[model samples]
Target: MSAGSVPWTDLDSLDIASLARRDGEKWAVAPSGVLPAWVADMDFPISPTIRQAVIRRLDTDLGYPAWFDESHGGPLGEVFARRMLNRYGFVAEPTHVRLFTDINQAMQVILHLGTEPGDGVAFHTPACPPFEDTIGKLGRIPRAVPIRLRDGEWQIDTDRLEDEIRGRQGPPCRALFLVNPHNPTGRVFRRAELLEVAKLAVEYDLMVISDEVHSDLAYPGYEHIPFASLSDEIAERTITLTSGSKAFNLAGARCAIAHIGVKTVRDAVDDHRGVLFGQVSALGVDALKAAWTSSDVWLEHVMAVLSRNRTAVAEQLPPEIGYVPPEATYLAWLDCRGLGLREEEPSDFFLREAKVLLNPGPLFGTEGTGFARLNFATPPRVLDELLRRIRGSLGC
Candidate 1:
């Protein structure tokens, strides 16, 4: 709809036909012309400032990374804290900030530090797969509590969460993990709603891990409240992870940060940090710095593209697919229940029949079984073609 709003150029500009040209038939995922509308990655080019910043680092010949000791208490940390506070009115102390190579590592380290074997870890359902995987792989029992979708909106099931935490049968739940402006679903919890969750966490004596990686990409007028920011009590027991990767299309850069307010929690998490784990990519650091502090023009453009893409998705998809328009993130979570397709069916149908690639809903969790997560960050033209292919496959 507007310049720089969408991430990728049109599908026709892509080699979509070539990608799926099986005996000259058009396909979307052909080896030579694969249209990767599946993952969170944006096909757009990086900002000039980020590109230059990385190049500036490469000019140093990729030497051992300089110490980020200064960053822990530096202006960068202060800037981050202030920016978040200003945006969400949730004051976070700079002393609580800790840098990391990526959020995935941060999640793992926090899980390892805060939880013990056999402890129950509760996650709001329809979440990122890694949230569940990290717990199970670490020997903690994975407990998923569903979030209710009502009136074309998504809300956490605080009642169910409370029941599980206070229930007689389950083992003591030790931790609660949240994805604010949640993944796939793109549900940006309101401030009061987040406070309710924080209250539950406090009541249960559960440690909190709030992932706000997609917070910045939120659409106009929707506010993203960080669980840790609810109050000092919550902040002290919470670990918040954020990155410029998703919002700025810099996942390849692998730079992120975690803020832990409490001394005991921070120390415990720090104990697990290894030499390789916290090592920041020099280029990644530069790119993140450029992205966070600068590139407003590029970001504005990206947001515009995402807005059009989101609108297009709502208007174009068949009635069989259902979703509330998201408040943030380029990801669209579509309910395929009406299509009579299983959780994995949409992805399979798209790849084999439509020649497109999408993230299957089930990957997020079992609750996501009859849904599909689509990336609408591509150019409008490309998105149109994707819709065309999908419609053709559905014969609708």
Candidate 2:
């Protein structure tokens, strides 16, 4: 059967040997016999449409692309605008969208254009580790706003964050890096919480850099609201970033787009296009366009698999390990602190004993201690084996 018609339970899994042979960081670093459930990358194959699009391009065009000269940002811009309008009820200007190699590169350029050195960027704790590191690398201080466990749910501590922005907790922050369907812990921010953040952004006049790469993965009951879509005022200051990578398993394609709503930032980026940055490859662009336009069925299957795996993780994991199956994403942010493992980072213990590699919690920030993030995007059989090994290791 075509991949689009394949049942979610029939997810094809690569054998350990084949997976390790791949060049991606997910499996390459792990030693033999280790089941790598680490990194944000998935173990599934790419959407058939994305693969075919790239192959078609290979057989056709091999020259420098001509669409780079467009004033309206070419096919990528149009695609983004159409998707935004269709997926969410947001009316986006095609001209406001800009393409980049990936979200990190887009973030770096946006940060350079928007803020001065030493300005603070406050984002949710247990944030994406590389993003936290990127703040430091850019000579900016990262102010952590913790997402605490309350009433058995992970929710943002908006009061504490507001205090930080107001200089009551620390120096007032200049920017707020918002990660919807937040990484590590997959609590998809509700509209009320988002409105609270919007109020903070408006009141504090902070630039909002929203990373919505996981927007497409918000689970059945939760909705992923675009921060910029809240209000025109919010949109003007928000630079929304997303990619086909997380949803379509196109991480290797290296394509991302940003909706630059702030006129000043947009103007600065427009001026520097190609001269400073913004040279997306033909392959990346084509693959992203196809993934966005032609691969809904593939995404639906992937989401179904993720939904089942999310439940499986919560039920199969040892009861001592704290876990709330996320409202979104294929990642399971496990609270291993309750287990009281000898290793400071629970990932280390899992790696050594269970032969399952996971992302260490401390890397996510001060709040990630004694936690570990597991990628559950592999097939059902593989995930079963992974959980079995972990259970055996724990003597549970």
Candidate 3:
């Protein structure tokens, strides 16, 4: 598939009838007439390069994989390191890279190894809902550092965050969960913002689990800086988590990578590698390896569509609803507090009235109240119809 053809034409040409027939969670979970835009998964098709790689792996071998030992320059480490170097100009070591089934699993494993129960974790809230849930289930307290909508931008209150970390006067927050190209709001941290976070981590002696799963999707003029790439001191205190799934639309492939820059956490995770943590499927490895190694041209195509769609969302959305076009990702966070619906909840209101399903704001944390996240990564016609439905529901 030529980069120009697949996204510009083929993606827009996709049939919703055909998409509904597929068993993926994005389309299937919704009722027959409801257009689902709640999930982060893109409506775009997987890259052909990834498909071929998975097929080849299935055709040849299904046995136990060789990279289980987490050796240096192993299946994912070298590939991940090379990708960091080529894509972001960050010099990462193959030896520090590790693999997991998905980002969630990677987080679980890292938290289990890095912190004990009852420790406090400082995370930017209105984040991926599950991160807060994970912190709770693992028996850790959550210190919410909310990024507020100020002056037409989603800016983190760095002062509030520092207070969350330092002013509590109890045990220091053991970990800081950093989500770059932030979810719900889709704000990409500029260099100055990242430096503030790094400074806080250093002052507080906090472990930073930098989640950059959406890093590859940052649009033009928005740069993603790996937290570990800041300085050797910060690197030693950070573990950067990311995946190719979001970029290539391969979430079903279920693979994620982490560069464990801190030696003690790495040693602890390595000491218990196979028994309780750190195992990835052979096919997942192959799929991601192919994606990282060869599917960037496909990504350029997808990014083009997303850039246009992001603009479309800003241009076509109902004037009553407040929306800020995301710096990265195909998701839009809509502020619908002004709508004055009977229920005053945008997701439920839209699902009932517009027949469009969106993720509720409160799921992302209290900061998400009066907000809803809309996935704009669908085919052009489908996206247009949905936006029309939304406008129609508003009686305008």
Candidate 4:
């Protein structure tokens, strides 16, 4: 089915009151009557295909998943490999794909298997907090390579990144955590930029753990390049992590796939699965299969709504708020530094005054201070109300 066949307009008009009653963190964490624009999950419903698949599984087979079996070349791995090849032209060997409960678990397992505890891991600053948190929790040094907003574009400070790796004191930098269509900032990195990153990884002999959950959400004009797909040498050094959860609004399913190009690295992760990493749920396996095979239409429609919402933010927000419409994801990284509000963090002010729950910039990293991340994957009417509340609070 094509995106044109879906009732995108009706689906986009989600009922806020009903959403608030749901058990998800995005809605449940916010106070009563406050609009939640904090968590990464979307307010939209799961794809019909995914919903049907779950129901079908519950009705017939609630048994253990045969994900590890080699019959028909492994179900989950085959689906992932086919999707990668058909969608992105990236050739993923089915044997190299591994399943996990979620991306966070995948990261933890990858770190445990690939590098020593004291090794340093580098990633862009103002990043998804989990990347830094995971590194620190694993006894690894978290080296933040900052990205600067220059001329209204978020550009990676490549020279600074190289210097950070080279100037490491105690532990050697062993891996780089890359977020394509970067979170919070939402910069869909260009091909040239990805090539540079690949080159840097090769030069430093660093393993690249690329989180590409937002790859499917790139805007009409932007393209998402898989880091491992750049070249054969880079592929050998890259572990690409992705999931259906982000684009398909299936976070609750808790399913993620990791494409491990290196044989030894794959073996290391697989060996530690039962003890350190938990198994993927049977329902998660079904949802993933349905998502990769039949949910593109639903995803396309969601992207359209998100694109409209992004434009609304840019056109409607007051001059005091700095917003560059993101190239991917429903997240809008607002530069609240110019607001000059009495409060140090704009998110607090928004929550109290505007009655909107936004993610505090400081949570992402020091570089994220004086900013806020807003989830715009809401209905247009609700988003309009949110903007109105903010405008009223600003007295603009």
Task: Give the alpha-carbon lDDT of every model.
Answer: 0.77, 0.85, 0.86, 0.85
Preferred candidate (lDDT higher): 1 or 4: 4
Which segments of model 4 are wrong by more than 4 Å?
1-9, 70-73, 168-170
In the range 235-280, model 3's lDDT, one tens digit per residue, is: 9999999987788777887788889998888888778778576477
Q: Which ten residues in a row are the worst by lDDT in model 4? A: 1-10
**What is the TM-score (0 to 1) of candidate 4?**
0.95
Query: Which lDDT tens digits does candidate 2 get at residues 204-270?
Result: 9999999999989988888888889999999998999999889987777888999998888888887
Q: Pick the candidate with the highest TM-score.
A: 3
Candidate 2 structure lDDT: 0.85
Model 3: CA > 4 A from native: 1-9, 167-170
**In model 1, where do residues sit more than 4 Å from their true spots?**
1-34, 68-71, 167-169, 272-278, 342-344
What would the per-residue lDDT of candidate 4 be over residues 38-122, giving only the tens digit for each residue? Answer: 9998877778888889999999978876555532235688898888889789887788888878889888888888999889898
* Model 2: how far residue 223 lies from native, Å: 1.0
Please, what is the TM-score per model? Answer: 0.89, 0.95, 0.96, 0.95
* Model 1 C-alpha lDDT per residue in residues 12-72, reported as the tens digit of each score: 2433333333221122333443455777866454677777788888886688665546336
